[model samples]
Target: MVDILEKLTIVVKRGKADKNSPYPPDLKGQDGADELTAEALKMGFTPDEVLQKALVKGMHLIGEDFSAGRAFVPEMLMAAKAMKAAMKHIEPFFKSGSVKQKGTVIMGTVQGDLHDIGKNLVAMMIEGAGWKVVDLGSDTSFEKFLAALEEYPDAIVGMSALLTTTMVNMKGITEKIKEVSPKTIVMVGGAPLSQDFCTQIGADFYSPDPQGATEYLDALVKSA
Candidate 1:
């Protein structure tokens, strides 16, 4: 059982989607995250166990590697793909309340920024870490974010912008969210954002990578 769980973690970390996936070269032909996750379920492992012990653990390692510059965007994307493949089996359990999500994250690329790659990466990583992600996609306006916040009152909001000009819009959106919900946590990211800019905009946090955001959300959930 432990061996199966470990294999699941390795496949996820190495970005192997299934038996047919040839990614990472060395792990070729091995049963990947998709197959191992299903097998773990058939072996009587609860969805929560498979998630926490396998998927989350694997993502954490990848996150650490990313933070340390040991991994790049391509590797992260592949891992996310593998994680997504595995998540297909666990989502039903989430719907049935057998697997509890840590929290909800409302994410998007700020208005005027049509880039989605970074936002999507963050969304996938956060979702893989057990939080429910509400992705609003690119070129999202403050009104759309506000509407989403209204729907998921307790959700944390994340804004991204790849352009320096578009990044300015985050200040307006952050201010508006704070105006309506004083307690809401707002996180900002993307190539043009800095910790100073985040603080200047009154946003709660700024991370250069998806893992930092995921860790912050995890800490928030535990404390809640």
Candidate 2:
């Protein structure tokens, strides 16, 4: 398990998707996330083991680097792709109830905001952290959020808005979510958002980047 865990983690962190993936110059032609994950499963490693020990660990390391400025968007995106490749092998187990996730997260770009770059980054980060992500996509309205919340009652909400003009809608959306689900936690982020704005809008948290959101959610899981 230790050997497989480390191998899978390295391939995923290096953004190597499969035997044929050539993105990483050094690891070219080697088994990647796809092949390594499949092999691990065949060897009897549990889905949760692959997720928590490999996929989540690899993504967390990359997220930390991105947060520290040691890595940039391209690195984050690549690592996410590798993580997704590994996920394809384990998703069936999660769906079949063989393993339980850390939690559920509902992500969306606020209404009137069409930008999704930041939202997508955060969703990928959170999903890689081992939580189930339900993305509502860009221009998501309060009603849409409400519908999702109805389906996942205990889900944490994450909202995004990259445009200053459209950001005000976050306040309304947060209010509506709180009105019906007072216990639900709400996190907000984007280029134009700040911790002060998060407080003003009644959101529980705010982050400038995907790594921050990932850490926040991971901490919540630990404290639970």
Candidate 3:
């Protein structure tokens, strides 16, 4: 049983979606995350157990690899794909409220910024780390963010801006959110963003990569 779980973790970390996936040449024709996750469920492993023990464990390792330059975008995307495939089976448990998430997180690309790769990656990584993510999508406005916050008042807000021009707009959005909900935690990041800029804009956190973002949020949730 432990071996099966370990296999599932490896499949997820290496981006193996299923037996037919050939991207990772070394693991050809072997059962991947999809099959392993399903098999785990069949063997009486609870969905939450599979998620916490296998998926999250795998994702955390993959995330660290990405942060350290040991992995690239293609590898990370593959891992993301594998994670998504497994998540399809686990989502029902979440809906049933049996898999309680740490907290809700509202995330989006800032207004005038249509770029979404980084934003999406952060959202996916956060969700895989056991938080319920409410993705507001690209080119999101302050009003839309406010609406989401109103719906999930306890949610931490994350904003991304890949362009330097759009990065300037983050301050306005941050101010608007703070005006209404001073207690709301705001995190900012993107290619053009820096820790100094994050502090200047009153954003509580800034991450250079998805793993950092996930780690920051995890710490916050665990402390709460």
Residue-level lDDT of model 1, residues 79-128, one tens digit each, is 99999999999999998998999989999999998999999888988998
For candidate 3, the lDDT comes to 0.91
TM-score of each: 0.97, 0.96, 0.97
**Candidate No. with top lDDT:** 1
Between candidates 1 and 3, the TM-score winner: 1
TM-score of 1: 0.97
Provide the clashing-pair count of each candidate structure: 0, 0, 0
**Residue lDDT tens for model 3, 94-212:** 89988888899999999999999899888878887988899999999999999999999999999999999899989999999999999999999999999999999999999899999
Clash number for candidate 2: 0
- Which is superior by lDDT, 1 or 3? 1
Model 3 scores worst on lDDT over the 10 consecutive residues at: 1-10
Candidate 2, after superposition: displacement of residue 64 in Å? 0.6
Best by TM-score: 1
- For model 3, the superposed segments whose C-alpha errors exceed 4 Å read none
